[model samples]
Structures are given as structure tokens and as C-alpha cells.
Target: MSQKFPEVQGGGSLIIAWQVKEKNVLVVGGGERGIQVAAGRILHALNADARVTVVCPSSGLNDEVAFRIAEKQVSHIDRNFEPQDLDAADMVLCAVDDPEASTRVWKLCKERRIPANIADVPSECDFYFGSVHRDGPLQVMVSTNGNGPKMASIIRKKIAGTLPDNTGAAIENVGLLRKKLREVAPDLKDGAKRMKWMSRVCESWSLEDLVEMNEADMSQLLDYYKSGEVPSLKAIRDTQ
Candidate 1:
């Protein structure tokens, strides 16, 4: 790892989000690292349907996660990871066999907000992804906080192993119900009222009962807000 890659920053603006959604992605490397990374890049996409292009002369996207990638799949460049790699790429991942080459790629990515990940070393990466679990539109992620990746991996496996299969579905329902609550009241106090509705929804409904919860009430609230009407909470929730 390069000394330039610090454990933490003293004073600098570090980015915490990505620019890719309906955007381009590029990965360079064909070995195990490249293949895994290529798969991951496709996995985290907000718009999992966006196009991704991988350029590694020796390797390409693997079949293991090909179905997921195919849904938002990547195209292969069939060439060595070169400076020209970024020309067509929105973000880059350097999984090359060469450390120096990876470092070089890191420099270019750093110059731009274009997210980059260096497989040879975590410290060199602009950002890293943690193992994630998803249910419908809900997601739970486990990040290492750029500390001990091995420990993070161990914890992630523990989480994934222990989590109930219905956990994600429950969370998704909560999110959907929250949207409904907001719709029912136009001038509901911002913080607690919104959060309170979510709390009530959780308390009132079982994970399985979420599907049976009425969306019409929530929809009516949102519709009232659109019509410039702000109803009281009790009126919206109980009296309708």
C-alpha cells in the first residue's frame, strides 16, 4: 500500500456518494479480483438497469452473477487496463495484476469524483462496498468503514446468516407505509409526525400484515397535501 494512502484524513473534503445510477462504469482486470469487482459494480447500481462496460484484456464478467448483471449488465472491452480506459468509463475499478498499474489508475480516478476501487489494497480505494442484503426496494448494507475488511466480512456473514428471510420484506413495508402516512396529512409536523407514523405502522402491523395495511389512507393524505389541505393527525389517521 502507498504511504499516500492514509488511514484517515486530517483536513480534506472526502466524498460519500457515487455519481453513477443511470451512468457508465468501467473495471480493469480479468483475474479473480477483476471478476468479483465487475460483479459488485453491477450489483450496487441504483438503476440496476444501467449499462456497465468492463475492460480487461484477459477476463470478462463471470457466469455466477451474470443473471443479475444481465438485468443491468456490462459489456467487455477486451483490452488491457490502460489510460484510455477512463475515456469511456464513468467510474473505474482497477483489479489489474500489477500494483504499480493499479496505483496509476488510482491517481487518475482521484483527480475526478469518478468512484474508484483498488482491489490490491483497500486503503487505496476511493470507496468500498459492503456486503448487502435486499428485499424488494429495501436494502441493508454492511460496510467495514474502511477498517478491517476481514472483520467486516466475518460480521457480514454473521448478519446474513442470522437475519430472517422476511426481514427485508418487513423493512420494505415500513418504507411503503411511511410514504402512505405522508400522503394523508399535508401540514403534518415534519420530524416526529412522520417518524411517529412509521412507529405506529410498525407497532400496529405484523410483518405479514404489511400487505394488508391500507394504502388508501396514506394516498388520501398525500392527495390532500397536493390540494393544499393540511389536516390534523387524528383527523387523518382515525376519523379519516
Candidate 2:
């Protein structure tokens, strides 16, 4: 008999890791609170490699926004949002203090089928920005479905504290090893073997061991893989 599966109960937003590299992101803000909100959203968009454009008046800009604009990290439209502004927007973050303007942007985005987040208004948001803890390429996000952002931030901090400082470095080392393994064993038939080797390496080595592995150690790993063996952490590091 097949194993029984647990029943599902769904009532929450779908969490996903979105890759917005080189995509167009529109950030709308105005007034004091709006600019503060816009600054954070702009930073995140830039970090994601999105082509960001902020729509706000000069008076609305905070120091961070002013600095980024001066640095040419993002383009600026020194005016309130217009319907034409949504023309090339792949995604939108609406944080304007003006409720009417926020609603208008949300409505237009809905009609255009662009995903949008209307700050602090769960009903209007197609997605919520969770509190995130980042370490190099690693990112851990916590969400309360836009109900408790402050609580999410607190929880993220707790989680971050428990992780090792060199966790990201270990992950980077493993990634490099994967690439070398692929080059040496570049056959469709060896896919499962490669996966097994990687899994064994991760399981056998401590975080510090993985972090200390250099390019020479990586080459040693490939040598062991060719013989259908996963070497101990000491064995690989000894080659260096």
C-alpha cells in the first residue's frame, strides 16, 4: 500500500524567491513617510540588480535617496507618479502617503497585470516584502502575510543569530566545488553520481572545513570523484 499523505490546509500567501536581475522596478513615494519607505525599497531593488526608477518630488527625497540618485545607482523622476510611468514597470512598490494616489497606482497595476505591493495595505498588495536576513548569496526571509512586519523582523534577527558567521563562505566553497565537478564529469549519466558526491561532501565536512577549502583542495576533490570516492575533509585539504 502507498503511504498516506497529510491533508493540506491553505490560507496564506505563497512564499517564493524571485530573481529580478535586470528587471524594471518602479518605486512610488511622496511626502515625509513616503520617501522613507521609498529609500528602503530602492535599496533592495538595486541590490537585486533591478533597473530601479523612483518617482517622487525633490522635497520628498530623504538623504539616502538623494545620495543614490547622485551616485547614478538609480534613475529619478522628480515628480509625482503619472499613469505613463507604469509603461515599462515590471513590478511596483507603492509607498506614497497619499491614499488616493496609492489606490490609483494599484488599480492601474492590476489592470496591467503587474505585481505590486501597496505599503501597509494588505488588501491592495499582490506581495509583501518580508523581513530578510542576508549573508552573501544566502537570504532568509520571514513573513506574517503583511499582518505583523515588526514581529517578522524580530524573528529574523533571532534566526540570524543562530547561524554560523561563515555559513555563506561554506556555501560559496561548495558552489565552486560543484562547478569543478561538472567540468570533470560532464556526462548526463553522471548526474546522480555528482549529486551523491556533493551531498556526501556537505554531510561529512564541518562548516569550517568547507570554508577553508581552496582551489587546490577542489582539484583534489575531482581526483577522488573520478575514482568513485568522496574524500574526507582532511584528505582534500592535505593536498594544499
Give the candidate number with the greatest TM-score: 2
Tens digit per residue, CA lDDT, model 1, 23-118: 777767666666676556655653455556766653354774455435645576666776766876677766666788788888888876667888
Evaluated at residue 108, the lDDT of candidate 1 is 82
Global fold similarity of model 1 (TM-score): 0.68
**Top candidate by lDDT:** 2
Per-candidate TM-scores read 0.68, 0.95
Superposed model 2: Cα runs more than 4 Å off: 1-3
Error of 2 at 237 (Å): 3.6
What's the CA RMSD of model 2 in angstroms?
Answer: 1.6
